[model samples]
Target: MDKKLAAEHLLQDVSHYHGPMIRQMKQLVDIYIKLAELETRREDTNRKVALPREIRSVKQLELVPVVTATIPVDRSCQYNEGSFPFFRGLSDSVTVMNGINAPKVVECFGSDGQKYKQLAKSGNDDLRQDAVMEQFFGLVNTFLHNNRDTWKRRLAVRTYKVIPFTPSAGVLEWVDGTIPLGDYLIGSSRSEGAHGRYGIGNWKYPKCREHMSSAKDKRKAFVDVCTNFRPVMHYFFLEKFLQPADWFVKRLAYTRSVAASSMESIFTFDDIYPLSA
Candidate 1:
């Protein structure tokens, strides 16, 4: 009951644009995915109609990008010093990413004759706190790296630039080629139906009961089975790996490493003792 309430409370401030943003992102990705398929088909169609090598290269070079949307007149995007100071303006090719918040992948031009891809996100309760947390984590990672007592690989903490445009909005340096851990665990796209979120429905083994049709019923079922939550969570663990025992062994080692790093980061900082102790 408490957990369900907390989840609702957290999502209370979800922006009205959240749904549109997700739809836009999906639409954009779908367009690109279809375009890629069409390109493959075109290549097959042109297989027999081969041109000269030089002509082929020229044709490829002639494929200039077209701007589909009108550029915004408000070209100026201000950022604090040391955070993309050379950033000049936004490009027309804005990509909405898949998520509840629906972040945008914006192309920014720099004065140094280069382009950068930054993630522009809005509809946050407070992004300033997120920026602060990132900065503090970076500091902790630096401390761990400098200390010889830390792991051999050091704290492989990835830090990127975060510029808060407002209390509830910000631009983050885009990290390419990343997958969500939740997606990794699921091994594919989320399941179908309204209550298809991870660990929400009934597990596969020893089929306890049918999955509730409505979201409210699903939530109620999940909450009622909280006492036997281990089996429910274990279902996901098994889903992630074929061999449960082997997965458990590896998970323990990974958990220990993460826990040690967390402890070291907190205890090493003298400022944390007063608050934590």
Candidate 2:
């Protein structure tokens, strides 16, 4: 064929071969652009949708209420036993409870008062002494309980139910438990142990010994599998168990410290006022 005719024929063949592919590529690009636009629209819609007022209000509510009571220091009062006095002025009571002052040292004329006096005297000024420590710890416990709601709110803590995987089912078949997120996030020994065993150990299997004639061969295969699997299992355990456990523990410790600091900031020695003489 002449050069001009040959070149024309070659160009025709090239277009014939590449025409469908070029058309398909353009269609794919159009589809991708449409998908990108849809995704952007979806994100914008999500951002614009506000939470319902009722749900928002419920979220704002405290997880638990502050529990406080008028614990009487007076043993002589007839109604002191198993009786919690309700003050009319809630604000005044809170002020008294949280006010800063040295703890009141009341002289006990009765037997109970005498015992209180003796206990206090034994502790002297050392809050760490047995009797004083008990009192201090008791107060600390109350303080923590009272402010639990505050800490939960500050941390934006939310509860969720988690089901764990069973050993036989493996991760694919594992179901989450129905426990509250608050409880699960606390990182109990039971949860940690279960996760460690199932996530790391469940995949390990004994060697198939049907083809092996010698016991030594079977044993060697088993040992080899176990040895090779150790690092993989260790990595899974660290990723799924140890790291999460550490994070949970640190958060809990921080919450406790915040609670303690909150208590210290509000309470004073004077708040432990002496009972009426």
Candidate 3:
């Protein structure tokens, strides 16, 4: 063979050998990038879980169960008639409050003059007339506030023993009997006002119940309720679930990625043919 032709042939052979290897290397690099992304996600989840409860931004107020009584529904009214009354009432109140710009804390008075006298003595200028009358029917402002405060007290007591950075599963189990911490944390249970069911805290408004029971309106009601309330429930549940450390660990596992180097170690051609050679 001619020397030049022989050299050319050898060069072509080398190119053929390296072409697939280059492609494989590119694939390996892509895999590594994916792996790194997965690792970063895992780290973020772990960090979120490790964060202290106080710093987590999951407010106790957010977990407070919506007051059942405050949901307006007239038993005598038809389902469609009462279905949206609760939201309407809220909107009305917001409009009034916007117009009034009432202080964050308002002094409420009973029928008696004595209550008004006491408030006046306290020098509270935020007092409003007939605050109770101003409130949406069936929705008592004080009752909701009181209930929220009570829930906070209970939650604070229950969570007092929960050590920071500890797995929430055991703590949840320990407090399960006292409060449905596990249920709320996991959000496995359906929420009130979900699926056209206007129930909250084991009781549904009589009008809502009647409406939901009607076969003709059931599907529509579900759609409306889910549309209006599902997002609220989702937000609340997600916040609740992330409050625990175990969830963080679970999230990391769910999003974990294999490193590129690890993949290369298992499948690289360097093992068969030394790269140095």
| TM-score, every prediction | 0.44, 0.18, 0.17
Tens digits of lDDT, candidate 3, 1-277? 5977997687678668666534443343332222212212222321211222222222122111111113355687444422431110010010001112121111112212111110000112221222322332113323433686533422111111211111111110012223343344323343333422322333333444555677486789776545433333334334446666766654443233123223333434455676763
Pairwise TM-score winner, candidates 2 and 3: 2
Window of ten residues with lowest summed lDDT in model 1 = 59-68
Tens-digit per-residue lDDT, 194-216, candidate 2: 33344454322222232234456
Q: Enumerate clash totals for all models, in the order shown.
A: 0, 10, 0
Model 1 clash pairs? none
Q: Residue 93 of model 1: what lDDT? A: 43
Q: Quick one: best TM-score, which candidate?
A: 1
**Model 2 misplacement above 4 A:** 1-130, 146-242, 269-277
Q: Model 3 segments beyond 4 Å from truth? A: 1-208, 236-277
Give the candidate number with the greatest lDDT.
1
Cα deviation in Å at residue 215, candidate 1?
A: 15
Model 1: per-residue Cα lDDT over 166-253, one tens digit each: 4556667777666565454333344322224444644532232443433467777766545332333344445656786878865665
